[model samples]
Target: MENFIYKITPSKLNGTVNVSGAKNSALRLLAASILTDRDVTLENNPNELLDVKIHVEMLEALGKNISIEADRILIKDESFNNELVWNKRSIRNTVLIAGALFARSGYASVPLPGGCQLGDRKIDIHLDIFEKFGAKINFETGETNDTLMLTKETELVGQDIHLPIRSTGATENSILIGSLAKGTTRIFNPHVRPEVLDLLDLVSKMGAKVEVFGQDYIQITGIGGQSTPITPIVHEVVPDNVEAITWLMMAIVNKSKMEIKNFPYAHLVVPMQFLLEGNSGISFDEASQTLSVDGKNATSFEIATGPYPGINSDMHPIFAAYGTFAMSNSVVTELRFFDRFQYLEEMAKLGANIVQDKNTITISGNIKVKSETVRATDLRGGMAVLMLLNEGTDTATITEAFQIERGYNNFVTKFNALGGKLEKVFPESTKEINVTKEALVA
Candidate 1:
């Protein structure tokens, strides 16, 4: 297992930090590539991310020929095995892969999805979507309900699916399956975020007709069984808005004036406006897609997580850390994932006065955080703990630090560039060898 040892010595940070391509966008975009047999190229892909690596492994298992160079990935369908029958780490995006596989091949058998342990993050909705698309689903007979098998006895035909809530994964699966299914598919109440739009852009380029009527609904015209295969084209992924906000929060808490390059301003208009309301001196350069942070301290405020154009649940922990630095009180409610309060207990070790009642959490701020060992329960929560390591000189250990790497590309390198004293420690090593900050810098 990997852990991060942080020696806090807060100092003024300088330099331009380049943001990587969006992890959420890249993962699904890779899955959408499985919808066609033609070659596809993805530029600006975050190939260094752990999640992206796992996704690549999954793609290879499906017999896709993938070549990665720098941040670009070229995928070619070679000998695709529709049945993903193997054992390895799995991500929630497997559901999307399943949808794509079902679209291309009439059957798919995949391992269950696994990612952050957010409560009630089930794929039942996804299964329902598959059923609506006329696929018969059942748990693999030999597996311990850890694998899902989907078989389409007849041709896949699209249907009108009205999602109960705005679900990003469900919406993405609908788009992927509908890309090649017969007839036009209509999806209602879809979560229209930058990542979803990124998938839409790629599928549309592949010859799927996708129409978005505001946030109300999306319609896709499938070209299944067409003589011409889905067009082979190159697509560039959008910048990661989550990583953009991570850098922004790092600037705010460390009181460092820095520039975050490749910042996706348009995708974060709502959240950026909200941060500006809290007295953050952040400026965006549209031409350069960079964010200039004046290193002003963030003020206490309240926010609720919702679908895009609103603060997302992934931003909850980052915002919680921002609130911890404010002199006043702040409250954050997790409207999407109710049991995402696992990070609150970990943040409390850093001297944050946070009290949780159901989905709402109240944080009292301005208290100096002490260096203490904590756990990175999830991706964003782990980064939040790192953001709070501003006051202590003692080493703070964050166990399962790999969680942080699963999302952010070269995060340790980026943080060290911003004057953060962080190092990764491998516990199995005889000498407790650390991937030193100097090594990363060099």
Candidate 2:
């Protein structure tokens, strides 16, 4: 409920947990599903996130036969409309859909993308790359939302394009369209985040030819020049690297003995380096694939968020929370999203001495949270408070729990499995907490 608040008391979490399917990967895969006329089943995809639901609702609006059986999403064969009719006015994935729609139907009308508003994730690169492939791009402001129409009267032929930045979104959009476009499309300076690799694998399984050059170049050969039919696919999403990192943070911040199973170590090579930062309490079991930590002491850390393989921009708020209890100073420079550190202000409510010197966040001193209530401004920012709550010496209330729910699947249950004592309080309910609260105690 909108009026509900989460009361999370400080506790230690210890258990093995599986990260949900990559939301980023699933969003792009959902968009890529439109490139096919055959049934597309995505295994391990979570259907509950608000962004995913919004994208699915948009697909259903365009006559996509979508159904869910447990964690697998069955998208039956259906004719897609030429117009990009989205239920939500804006989602960052819309730019992605525009690319897929243009390739599949030769026309796409999408509202300017909006989702997880950290900063201006510009679509200029998207439009520029599409234009390189001879797409006719136009912008018109509408009453409800400003629409970006990408119409290709002729077939989309592959082109070699160099991206100034290795953007995951831009790369995904390019790959989606390029997979269906006539001829070969070569993307230079592409982001090869594990999630992007997952998309490449998904498309390759669905009949496209993709080649990776080290890490930055992705060469895609379209499926028989748009004449070939898309083969139906059954693909599992890549494990969420961020979620794995969250559990790692949980291990350190809570300072509890914990085992995090299904930890994606390969994708986290760069991030893991920073998190470890010569810390002795955490160790990895390569054979068993577990990250275990005993919270005997806090490890000092400093990091700067960049593109993929670098620390993710989304991790800034989370690590900021972890920085609170570190034995020494931790500095984070968020290069991707300018406004990402805004959540740090809220964490200060818990007595985190986080100071922003321009884009870099300087966090000093170990803190015991005195925060009673705080707001979750954005998706990841919202989760930051929960990390802060885990450090609460007393009970703390985190408002806007929906933001966390949007991205995370079974948030409370997973945390509870790790020994977290959290409860949802509904102001509108006649009872303090709904009957569902009994499930925890039971």
Candidate 3:
């Protein structure tokens, strides 16, 4: 909608909510499914969000037969020979597809990918690894047509590659290609998101030699082809840390308490520890995978967003929302997504005292939100606005909510179920609401 309002009423969130599958892991695993020529079934998968649906469509275009029922995806025609083609407009999942196509057909050519406008997420690391595995990449500088050609030696010959940074996407790409390469591929300075490990686990189950060496290294020995068809396996997607954090921040900002069920404790350790540092009372029971946040009087603290096991970049916007009601200043330094501070402007519209620099957001505590229309800059940013709106501000009109729909399935519905008053107002209807002087006077 051009402009839409969510009329949230202040309410206590006391019940439990189960977390869905990890979107990050599912994207990689879905790409990895193309590695086999047999029927590959992924269990514990979450609902098909926009990115997943787009990836599936891209695969289907490349001649992969796919079927979805419930939380499972059955991918047959594992003999992935055709080039994975996609609309030049849809490049969000291209990197993941690159790994899968490289593993399956020994070559892949697709346009450069797209996603959040978080500055240059250089594919240098990915391309460097692919080149080390002997793939020729040709980038058309002026044009959108980019090509990656894999040769006879296209099969990745496993070798020790050290990463300068611990990028999750690069690490997963390396693992996927390494699984089908000729020798053992050892990656150092790698990211160990449990979701990435889950994909490795799946590849290992498919007769690949994959192992996690402590927290920094992953070793994978090449297995040339799928030994057998992937049997339908039940894989419960890990709970989304960002989602849990969003709800938790909402609870705190609203001066309400909530018990989040299926909360991924391990994945959220860093953020939870940070929240606790901010004086937000939180209790966790690992056995039940539940986290309870009693945020009746939550304070604010500084946070630096980092990679996994650190304050994640994805959780920064939610943290920003929580900062609005904190008793003290909250400094959020986004170390990963340097340019993600654009959301601060939207937060400012809600009367949040926020200032942005190159990579840091200095948030002054104690904001009194005013009803205003704001636009979602990105996925997490959209969720942040939604969380802030839940505290019953006069009325908040948010645009670009479609960005939220990209990652979250029926988000407004879920929030509504929790007593949030939000209605999906289309742009056409909003056009008729011209503020007249008489209406304002009344």
**What is candidate 2's CA lDDT for residue 380?**
82
Lowest lDDT block of 10, candidate 3: 433-442
Worst 10 residues of 1 by lDDT: 433-442
lDDT of each prediction vs. the true structure? 0.83, 0.78, 0.71
Q: In candidate 3, how many Å is residue 44 off?
A: 3.5
lDDT of 3 at 295: 72
Superposed Cα RMSD, model 1: 4.8
* Candidate 1, 296-381: lDDT as tens digits: 77788888888889987899999999888888999998898898878888888989899898999998988688788888878888
Best by TM-score: 1
Flag clash pairs in model 1. none
**Model 3 bad stretches (over 4 Å):** 1-14, 78-81, 140-155, 225-234, 277-281, 428-442
State the local distance difference test value for candidate 1: 0.83
lDDT of 2 by residue, 271-387 (tens): 788777656778888898777877565566888898877888878887887777787888888887786665777777778788788899888857777856887777788888888
Clash pairs, candidate 2, are: 13-418, 255-295
Cα distance off (Å), candidate 3, residue 133: 0.4
10 residues in a row with least lDDT, candidate 2:
433-442
lDDT of 3: 0.71
Query: lDDT score, residue 378, model 3?
Result: 75
